[model samples]
Target: MIGMYDDVVLSFSESKAEEAGMARSMTAFGRCSDIVGGKSITVELKSVNNRFLDCNSRVPRAYGAVEERIKPYLQSRGVVRGKVDVFVSVIRIDGGETELALDGEYLRRYIELLRQMRDEYGLRDDISVMTVAANRDIFTETESGATEQDTEDIMSVISRAVDTFIAMRIAEGENICRDLCKKLEHLGALVGEIEREEPRMNEAYRARLEAKLRAVLEGRGAGAPDEARIITECAIFADKVAVDEETVRLRSHLDAFGAALSSDDAVGRRLDFLVQEIGREINTIGSKVSDVHMTDTVVEMKSELERIREQVQNLE
Candidate 1:
């Protein structure tokens, strides 16, 4: 039930349809707050597109230790490429009052070491309890450091916030995918128009060559022009301007672009490379084809390509 060219056309159409889903673009914001061990901790995540992952965080001094852990955790959670910023704030239910614990062992060891230093240097024995207590290292405050339970609770909230952020980014990426696919479809149609006009170019060149040959022969009083020679010259002109290779490569690039869009991996760099190839092929077509209609079509295709490039810039 299919014609000769139907299979090729259907294959092309199927490839286009396969490009409906992808997950490269990223731009989202999410915030979550929860109560843990009588403290309220809030986690905020904001992400935008970047070629590589660049994660930074702002957290309360007590939670500063988690800042180093957050980057690796986010990278594990599929944040492979972006400019992501995290903000964490903690509010204590006990009015921010810190409970300090004294380390008797460390205090005794430290004072003993100080006395040994003074004796060895033959210095004055003016060491007092007040002087020994001045060092903050002797006391450990509950609010200044995170316990194991606090770290666990913070991670829970962060995981939830990251889920929400990724969800938002995927939703926006789907919309962008649809827009880019539409533009690609339009570009393909333009290429088809050029293809249809391709055969006519040969015909036009042949006719012009024949006319010029006839005019020259008539002026020289020759009986007739060499028909075979005119045909050979026309063939050479057609070869000189042929765009078949460029069009075929352009179509291949389009298919690759679509496939990359629907892939699960980070494809921003791949898509950018494909875009350059597409643009190069289009430029080649523009240079070879001198027909006014084909030239106009090439111009429109370039405009559409530029729009797609702008959108691609936002991808991860």
Candidate 2:
């Protein structure tokens, strides 16, 4: 597989989109820094492996929907094949506005409650300034919503941060692919060894049968035609536990696996299936190879295959 490391940046500037009143099109970007008119608003998108683009935004509730819009942006880049856990954060680098607000509905209701309480307890004052300020929704000051112009400016910044995040993930994917390929190569080598040993194994089985027949006939004069009996029993045992066809099919599957690994497409599911097939072949070998040495070798191959499977889980 070819490892790709890339970053894309698109910007929306207030001065650029002023006539439209809002940014006309969204931009997909990477790690961002926006410096405008001596003030800056920075947005960072940090993405990691996930089953999908499960995004979390660290901004005012008013701007939470921006995460949804980012979905198309990420998909457009062809980098959305795997799970991506994105954390979006917006920071006002140089603050331009500090907002204050009163919840009129909440304040009105508090006043009514104060009046009722004073009458019941015979208190002189019905309302206190401290109590009004302490009421959860009665009063507050904070950064407000993104204006049409603010969106135009902020989007430009966010796009840059996304670019940085994608670059990092691509690099990470590269490293993972490299390690995975090495494991695949090792597995291929082990399969090749089995193929080479198959002929030798057949010869060994014939030798074992002859030795067992002689041992039986040597013990008694009445042991007649033991050669014929041994040949029949040996044939039955060999047919019952033969691994020749298993090895051949497994070798073919290994070649197909190499093709899938090198393809520049969404092959995660395909590779997963191939791994299952490979596991099946190995299990068959373990069961058929009455030889202790062959069984031990199959066990070791399975261990390596398991490690390879784990690394493939993170592929895109």
Candidate 3:
């Protein structure tokens, strides 16, 4: 088994992920900080596996304009699919304060509803200001809107974090690729063993059948049976038990698995499809072959394939 961090090389404390391979099933944390408009801004990015891109952001209300921009930025940085959560926090160098406001319309509606209930159901009219204040939505905490310079500063920090994040995923992916390739090699060897045992199985079956027939004929005081009929029977039996088609398809599937692993795009689904096809071929070979040695080889191949499948699940 390849250790989780075996392929990653971390060079600095600021980067969550460094130079390495890629994997879809991974978690990475990234953080970056910089000065913008004489204020210190820090950005953090957290990524986890998902079938599609789902990006969310947490920033000061004033910088809400950047929330919609986070996903595109990540996508541009090679985040094709994942559940990525970004947090951007700004600290004014001079310790600036935030603004606040009340939603007067919402408050008025709440008060009117309370009064209506009090009149209709004979409820107490003691709805104090404190009671209404319990609805946090009555007040909004506002911050200064992010200027063009502030946006650039924030994106710069986030880009650095995204770079580290992608590096970690790639490192993990490389580890998975190495493990999967080994399993495939072992599987191919097992397939070769099965191929070797196939001819022996046919010969063994024919010899056993002929011996049984000869014994029955001799016990019945009969002469030697026709050789041609015996040959025909053996041929038919061999044809029925042949694994030519299965082996051919299995080999093709193995090649496809290799190609998928080497692809630059997201190959997780493709690899999964190939694994299923390979397993199917193995099962077919198991059912068609009767030799104990061949059965054992099939079992071994299945084991290797299952391991490969496990690793493929971690890829994208």
Choose the strongest candidate by lDDT: 1
Model 1 lDDT, full chain set: 0.78
- Candidate 1 vs candidate 3: the lDDT winner is 1
Model 2 worst lDDT window (10 residues): 18-27
Q: Which is the better candidate, 2 or 3, if ranked by lDDT?
A: 3
Local accuracy by lDDT, each model: 0.78, 0.62, 0.75
TM-score of 1: 0.75
lDDT of 1 by residue, 272-307 (tens): 899999999999989988778888999998999999
RMSDs, each prediction? 11.1, 9.5, 5.4
**TM-score of candidate 3 against the unseen true structure:** 0.75
Segments in model 1 whose C-alpha atoms lie over 4 Å from true places: 1-21, 95-142, 213-224
Quickly count the clashes in candidate 3.
7
Q: Write the per-residue lDDT of candidate 2 for residues 1-316, one digit (tens) a residue.
A: 2121122132433222212111111112245665753335666655444554455565543455565566676565545454444544444556546566777887998899889989988988836788778777776545565555655565566666655655554445555556666777788777777777766776677678777767777776664655677787777765766678888888787777766755655566677788899999999888767666676678888998999788766665
Q: What is the model-wide C-alpha lDDT for candidate 2?
A: 0.62
Relative to the unseen true structure, what is the C-alpha lDDT of residue 14 in candidate 3, on a scale of 0 to 100? 27
